[model samples]
Target: MRLRGRKGIRESLEKQEDLVVLQPSLWKGRWSEYFGNSNPIHVELGMGKGKFISELSILHPDINYIGIDMYDELLRKASGKVRFRREEDGIGLDNIALALMNIQGIEDVFAPGELERIYLNFSDPWPKNKHARRRLTHPGFVNKYLSLLNARGEIHFKTDSRNLFEFSLNSFADLKLRMRAISLDLHSDGLREDLVPTEYELKFVSQGMPIYRCEVVVGQQSLEAHEIRLKQEGRV
Candidate 1:
């Protein structure tokens, strides 16, 4: 469902420099200053169309939010949403920033222990076994996240794909990581007041599909053990 080849999309994104960060790596380790406050920074990794992050920014002005996506069209659309919401709500855009970049280079954009939380909303399933390495929740990516997150930081994930959800659970377990707030049917009892459903989540829920959700907390011991395992497996 990604928008493709929309003319002038790149230009549109360039014009959104106030909202879109073109050189995120330069801001590494300085996100707090970029946001002009010491507010905890939260990221919507692989944020698609920007609906969820935009809503979250509006809901929690106390937090600094970054939304990252690889597609220029998606980033453009997300910028529009944030801009419209700002005007609609009369809120300044200081708390929100968008980046158009691939997630694999995320470490270059934020220094170690820079992030407080990361949201993975409806990420690509990458179902094939050969492609498992590319899944965001894969152990390799989890290792990268560990390097970027503070000691107590957490990764919040939600998805409608059962295969991906099961894989993620096992992946975290393999690292001996701690997980909490697991839900096999997130909206079954009615949406939580604080929850802001992503665009894909809303579509799937309307069709009676279940959403799987979990939060993985960063633990020093688990991280050390996971790194050892990776080294033994010649993965690190």
Candidate 2:
């Protein structure tokens, strides 16, 4: 949930220097360098309030994590969550960074092949046919993601919206991306290990909503083919 136009919201975000970087261009291609490590980088593409990625960084300290969200309303809350964890634990996870950017402009901030993994969690469905191209799983965004990811890189996606899940599956297939894992009902499907519930994920699971998940691998060479298929489908 958005904090809804909190006064000085931008200033609040500015105070969170230990957790998020509001201006990320300086560390664009040198992201891993900011972390002082060569570990593989993974990004959560639409990290609303970021509960998932923060926990993920704690769990997989060996891997670097970046959380990108467009709203300061969301980032402000996420920063507080991380700061509270640090205050209580005496050791906040250091393997994480946050960026505020429109997903479409991500290409301007990161070099091609910079990410080893990307996660799209409960993205906006953009359910109407006219708005389909704006969906995060649309071929346009998928192609951009593929370009940013290193060869053999994988994207992990999760959603509670069945329509979006099905749509994303078709998007991945259209790109001929290989799927290594899929779960139509993740919480009850016997794939419980390593499942770190995001804030929204917890709410949905509490209400008995089924969560959909999949892992897709795309190669750099296959990108052109995906674009060709998009034009063929008139999705362009």
Find the candidate with the highest lDDT and give its number: 1
lDDT of 1 by residue, 117-180 (tens): 8999999998899999999999999889988988648899999989999999999999987787
lDDT against true structure, model 2: 0.83
Top TM-score hit: 1
User: What residue pairs clash in candidate 2, if any at all?
Assistant: none
Per-residue C-alpha lDDT of model 2 across residues 1-236, encoded as one tens digit per residue: 33468789898778777678888877889987788888989999888877888878777889988999988888877777766666676766578888888888888878899888899999888889899988999999998988889864778899999999999999999988877569899998543667877888888888888999997867654455556766998988
The segments of candidate 1 whose C-alpha lies over 4 angstroms from its true place after superposition are 219-236
- Pairs with backbone N, CA or C atoms under 3 Å apart (clashes), candidate 1: none
TM-scores, all candidates, are 0.90, 0.87
Clashes of each: 0, 0
What shift in Å separates residue 25 of candidate 2 from its native position after superposition? 2.4
lDDT of 1 at 129: 94
